[model samples]
Target: MTGRLYNSEQIRDIEQQAIAEMAQGDFVLMQQAASALLGLLKQRWPCRKRLLVYAGAGNNGGDGYLLAAYAQAEGYQVAVKCIGDHALLPKAAQMAKKATEQAEVPLLALSAAFKADVVVDALFGIGLNRPVSGDYASAIEQINQSSCPVLAVDVPSGLCADTGQVLGSAVKASVTLGFIGHKIGLFTADGPDHCGDLLLEPLSIPQRIFAAQEYSARQVNGAQLLAQLQPRCAHFHKGQAGHVVIVGGDFGMAGAPLLSAEAALRCGAGLVTVLTRKEHVPALIARRPECMVHGVEAQQDLHPFFLKASVIVAGPGLGQQFWGQQLLQQVLMQNKPVLLDADALNLLTQQTTPQLKQLILTPHPGEAARLLQCSSKEVQQNRFKAVQALHQQYQATVLLKGNGSLIAGEKDLQLLNAGNPGMASAGMGDLLSGIIAALWAQGLNAETATALGSWLHATAADHLAARFGQRGLLALDLLTEVRTLLNQPCSG
Candidate 1:
């Protein structure tokens, strides 16, 4: 997850370097780009012949013009709707315009309606910084309103390449074709919703150009992270798998820790224990006899559990009552790998103690806002900045859950895009807490466990939703799927 996502500045620098250093001239690069788009477009919709392209005033427009020229040459009727004056176009785009003229592609007036099978959006690219207005806004809306499948060039116009924030009006593209480096906004925040069937074309940038540049963040790579847990050997026993302790489920909230414990066991933890209220112990133990349930009322009751636990997952249904606080304080002192989630995060905001060496903070947007002393809107405004601030402020790994879940540590930042809308249900975070804790108990480092666990949690949910619709997808449904994913072989 380290070098997969980049900011506008980084992508711009790489593009500039490519233009200056590579033997492939700027016009040749544009032609190669158009060729890549044509290949994908033909593969996706070979039967569709009518092509309508919205050309702007930049290199992005140049790409669209060239694509139109390529399609026209292939006998696909093509038309160009110029959103900007061709006189203002850059050198490469002007060259592309000349190419389009030579190809005899028709030019349509802006007032005309869309009649093509596919609409190509080349109006804006990574350089967009302000809210789209006037003709630009009109063009974006027209593209969105069209029933035809739209292909966005480079980026969906109006999206912030640096942060993924949408401008006044952004095209909801059926697909977005990116170039050079992956933009940060395309994977997080509003980017996931706007970008459909994402594809990246490196345009064959030389290896040295990329080798010299650094990235802003990375995609939460499943195969690399899954490698942390090798397929278990036949000789390995339950004792070698490690022990996980779930320390929440106060009074009426017994189900949270039970769900967590079940996930821990399902995800390969050798042993699972739930410490909860004395009244709820019988039912918790009855529902899942595999977990050893212990009821504790006093702080001293945590001693034996902490002594034997390889990792502690705290805060799932851990109410703000004295009973929960008493145990949390002692749990922190145990010096074992711990995950602070649910109500635990709410309580941690009041504490001044320095966090532990292996403590992980998993907070949804609202909870994250509480911990950061800011509004939830502010946290969502720029999630990377927020996660980084949380990691630096608490001096521990932080996982911010949302549309695109982010995992941040001292030197790592990973984003998970495998989840679905169905995950809006309850007990999801509790289940995630268990998965991470189980991995930690089984000997993965805190960062790996957090990143991989996030991936597993989301991917499992996605798998279930894909088979059975996203609605009403229970958190419990993921346990078996998680086991299946863990045992299956993964490809890079």
Candidate 2:
């Protein structure tokens, strides 16, 4: 009933179902979870023997206690930092603590300057909604400030499992092992930043339990999405690829639309046309001779070019001047696939609607905030909600760009799982708009184009960052890889 990511409620339901149908007790599940964590630790960090665990008051803490017991049994030096009172611990947690005590694992209460080869963060799990404070906050801070590598049992403590935001402060882990079904929180917003090398551990649950539940969203990595590209026939021609019209590049921002046009060309747009100011025409032609760069003085100049546009990509380098507004007005009137970005999104806020149906809106958080009449902070607090609201308001396929880019459409809600931090440069959105337009022109629908375009853009960025490093990466650095990726037979 679902995809790759599930909310906390859904994960709980799956756990309940597993416990009921699989005839597994809660204690058995905790034991299996702890065993899984220990196995992962041994496999990934065999040289490290000193283990420090933070045991909270929930079943999540119970997992930590059992892990300490299992590790102690295996002769690994282990210590537990008992955060909450043992009397307040859950039934399973009490049993786990008793077992750990039986195993002779030392339990202490110290909040700062802790040293361990590896830290196990089992303080909180998916149910925590309130912000961390007091002693819990101090422990998380110490964990973050420490030099030890952290293995978050299910999720990093202090992070909201549903919204993927920090409740107050979150433990930054070297690796996070998500149990049972993958949580939706682990793949969006700040989730990607806090979760290093995130992985899933099923804890030996039966597949039938998972197959019956529903998920919130899908984790769409570029590698998994690339299999959609089919081989072209020998008779296929440039004419069959479709025409993509780009409007923007007013005065000082000429580089924006040019980047978009180049991206479209590289992604196999049949015929590419750029409607920009006369000032950018020479540079546009000089940069990419194949693109038909027309110097438009008014909306009339855009009229001639719109006739051939299979798809229109607006807003790249589109300034908020009279020129950019005029171009946008003409674009909205056309009954074609339209993509809004950069200044075009900025301009969209000021204009009256023209029934832009076959449309796609690619907005970063700030632009999304402007469109939604909310703060960027609000939009980022729950990215899933913001993207859905954008789609509902604009009635367009919406892609919200950020740490883990999110796409909202009529069918699927996908989050990008392939991009790196290096893509946080100027002109990335412009390039993304172009790629989406090119794919739309080449025969995909607006929604598919937006989703695939997002994956392609991120995948290309990842390919470049893999070799050159992300510190000084440029937007244009992805063009070569984008072309190479489109031509090759990509395996999912």
Candidate 3:
């Protein structure tokens, strides 16, 4: 994660340096790396003894031939299906060719590789920048069609290791063995889908090797955040965490604001207030008397409530009523740090002018598409573009919630790879608003609060879904988990 991220050329530069500095034989390194991949395959798929290796004429194919030899030594039926003529291979690759010949492993054509138990795809690696066509393309398609699992070396062929773009066709790997550093492309765009269950090996390189490199492979892990946190001081009071005002809960949707207020209070926000329709006040107060419920029928009732809020959460179950719109407009006018969700996003689109600052807009794919004036399909196709465009246009931090749960600003973007599929259910977004608001009230700035808060909420749900399963998981399941995360002692 420390080294500068490299494209195909940079990877080649480092590989050459490693070969020279290590003073190891070129064939030895290739054989050793291939043996590691073979070991992983055998350990993971103990029942599979028949292995098919699809190889090209380059070094990637040389590694494949070395693996075929190891598989044969380990008593597995090994076959090296050479995709093209062997005359194009380099000297080191020819050494591998001699080893495969000495071992007497059968060299079959592309089509003949389909019936094996496991397929080792070494046809292409990071060097591929163009489309896969002709026989190689056909062979890749056939390999994908087979039921056997694939173990890809370096990266899935045809997938750009920088931008994660697919080059015409790409290999689908059940497990991709990455060497040296984890490529930044493997975590973004099409990287997640093409490279499955990625396992990185530093290739026995020391940590200092990355100091000379310039790119970044930043990963967001929740445990790291726990260590930097300070515990609650003895002098801390109930109201010390600050008051959070949650605006919304139009008429019949009282439960949304009520849930949000309760979640905030549980997350250590000192005072929680709910500004909702007049009719829903009594039931909310009755359910959670700890929450100070206000019967605000219009914008006039909002100013007094807004004045007491350290953080504001707008538009949870907030219908597009006149009161809802007026209340949101008044809150936006205050310019205090705000968490925008649900109807607040919808209401913003109605504005002809534009958005203001100090705001976090949490929008799903559909909402993101509307804000960008593009189709949802277009947003999904290039989500990084959509999120970046949204942040640039709106000048607000955006949490574009989906599978990867992207958090983007005007200058930076981080994808939260921790959220589970179970979080797709109801009231989840509202709960997220409460979490962000609580963190902001506790003195975290807008960006840190949003990033840390969103990660915590989503990650907590992921942990819960592990126990409850995704089918019936709900937002309320995260309440105790959030409290637990904030209250726990920080870890290194």
Worst 10 residues of 2 by lDDT: 221-230
After superposition, candidate 1 runs with Cα above 4 Å error: 1-3, 230-235, 489-492
Predicted structure 1: lDDT: 0.88
In model 1, the Cα lDDT at residue 478 comes to 91
Over the stretch 224-342, how does candidate 2's per-residue lDDT look in tens digits?
45566666788999889989999988778999998999999999898999988898889889989999998888887888788888999889888998988888898888888788888
Q: Residue by residue across 205-242, what tens digits does model 1's lDDT show?
A: 88788878888888888878787787677898987888
On a 0 to 1 TM-score scale, where does candidate 3 land against the true structure? Answer: 0.86
Once model 1 is optimally superposed onto the true structure by TM-score, how far is the C-alpha of residue 39 displaced, in angstroms? 1.9
Query: Best-fitting candidate, measured by lDDT?
Result: 1
- Report the lDDT tens digits of candidate 3 across residue range 1-492: 532344566566666767777655567678777878888987889999999988887888898998898888889898888876679897888888788888899988766634589988888767777788888888788778779999888788767776566778888889899876776566666777888888877675545556565543245455655544556788988678889999999877888898788888887798999988889988998999999998887788889888878889999988887878888888878857788899888887876534556888999989888888889777765666788788888788888887666777643466666776678888988988898888779887676677777778977887888887877888888889888887676433
TM-score (C-alpha) between model 2 and the true structure:
0.96
Model 1: colliding residue pairs: 164-185
Is candidate 2 or 3 superior in TM-score? 2
252 Cα displacement, candidate 1 (Å): 2.5
